[model samples]
Target chain A: MARRPLQEINAGSMADIAFLLLIFFLVTTTMDQDIGILRQLPPPVPEDLETPPVKKRNVYEVLVNSRNQLLVEGERMDIADLKEGAKMFYTNPNKDPDLPILTRQTRGAVEENITLLQQALVKDPKNKQLETDLKKWKGKLSAIELIGEYDELPTSALISLQNDRGTKYAMYISVQNELSAAINELRNELAQDKFGVAYSELNPSVAEDKPKIKAIRAVYPQRISEAEPKDISGN
Target chain B: MSKFTRKGKKGTPAVSTASLPDIIFMLLFFFMVVTVMRQDDPKVSISKPNATETEKLEKKSLVDYINVGTPIDTRFGTEPKIQLDDAFAEVVDIQFWIKENRDRRDEAEKPLITTSLKVDSDVKMGVVTDIKQELREAQALKINYSVNKGSALDNN
Candidate 1:
């Protein structure tokens, strides 16, 4: 407001200020991450398989009370050999390899898994929840029973087990993470083969332990089930 | 008009930024303290598994919550009647919720449904899975599991 000649604002100073602001923002900006499943969003669900997507109808309810009593198919699973039986749920002798992975575990693997579980319970007897956890783990094991050849099987069959809401979330989440891992494994293994089920991959230390190829994906109700060719094509 | 001052050369534009770090730090601290963290706490206990891929998110739209009280009115009634957070309920309810959410969005926008499952840390696996299965069955556009800071603070 001074009654004197005004000096023009230098354009050079403005350019310098702009560059500084640009650098500041560039240095501090965070990357855009995918917090949850980031899909194209109109919908991510693909069409259901020509074969009806396995519904929740086949879920076998396994209940474990706070006391750790295991129930499978509505009967008490012998705590001593529950794993052995679960393995048998997945593996049937000399039938079509065309069978589902949800029903193809071996009697021996089931036994070994049960023994390991029993050992865990025996080692950690103070915690009553361990036994309950061991019971639910069986279904996950059945779905992800990895074979000697590192081949994997289809575990698309949804298995629902019920535990008390009062139970620790850790126990449930671990079981779920295990199931997701198994399902992920099953999908990766089958992605390469035809007719789906393949041997479970064993660890590279032993070729039998290497991960098998997986090929199955999950489908739930409520979402439109249009066949997205990609889901069916890659396999 | 001809007065000379020793500080005449101090009028550099860069001088303004001398205190920029402190000013910015103070403002950031002010917001950090004054602004209540818009956290999505179900006020229920939730146990989240450790995953390297997990990330913290800012405001997410109406994600579902589960507060595990004594399970009552649950499908697993024979086990015991303890109040359950929505996590242990049937798949159908979750599907219904998702469809409702999807339908409520703006017509021109791509229906982006972000179904979040926040179960108490001690909730049952069967219950959690059932909820997830329901969301999946509902054909959720995208689903994410939320972890509580209290649980996450443990390892650190």
Candidate 2:
């Protein structure tokens, strides 16, 4: 027996329902953002505050050549080291949340260090003498080294620059300048955070520490080639 | 014709709206579970760039992050890996985290509607763009790469 024509179901309410549902989802569904760790950089107070060490503190020497063989400190560090340092940086330790001013002050010093490093490296034609000096310390050619002695090193942030074969000395400066600018800006922004503590006395102010800020350099590979140890002597 | 019997479709069942109410109810339920039930992953707070115009948002432990900072040279120089906090993450690591977190939320039927990226203030524009490019490709393009808006003292 043929089934009676399925009653032509009229579900006009589907439209109202759909529209209502759309509005409901659109309205009630909170598409709010998940904020990351960010706090304001408060103004500096006079007293030396008890500060927490930077939570993400790992110093890495990032050396980039024309060939893009990256280096850490004096040694040729592969990509793996980069990850470790970055992660270690994150794990260094969270600053005590109270000392916002301290965070700002220290960050300023790092900013200067980064800025100076950028300036030194990005200069056109590059200062050959300085690159040479930096390299002499690196170890003369024949050594694909990865590190330098860590005893009592300068506290400044350093970014050494060297170029690959056939690269213009100008390229060395260009890279240095670009990298420096980026890093300094970041430093400044970060320093303004609310989480840091000053472990030391506020004897030296950020303003006073300007010229004494950390140092950054642009070392040419040809120059660094000299610093490369005699593979046998160093290894 | 028999008096044109009513075709207004059962007077809309007085249920107001269907389908969507069910869908929204389901979604609301899903998020409520996420915000309350799911084991919140450990969160590492980067020194986020503060913004004066910014509002206090509900902090999410499940943030999709792109670490735009100096990657560590773990073995000094032998192996360079990008660490998402202490986790030795690769570019693929970022990709995996992005995908994994998003997927985890998605599986629970709560697709991540947004993301946060921590780029060091000194990070380059190109680097930020590169990360953004990756996020876009991953379809987690809706993101908030934190930046220092202005000193809080700016207004005062």
Identify the leading candidate in terms of lDDT.
1
Against the true structure, whose DockQ is highest?
1
lDDT of each: 0.43, 0.39
lDDT of 2 by residue, A46-89 (tens): 35766434322223334455344556556676533443433222
Clashes of 2: 50
The ten-residue window of minimal lDDT in model 1 chain B covers: B147-156
lDDT of 1 by residue, A1-235 (tens): 7698888764445545545654555545444332421111233344563555563324434454543345655778643343333333333234433333334345466567778888988989877787876764454354355322222234453344455533345543333333333344434445435334333322336543333321122211112121221111111
Worst 10 residues of 1 chain A by lDDT: A218-227
Docking band of candidate 1: incorrect
All candidates' chain B TM-scores are: 0.48, 0.50
**Cα deviation of B109 in candidate 2 (Å)?**
5.2
The fraction of correct interface contacts reproduced by each prediction comes to: 0.23, 0.03
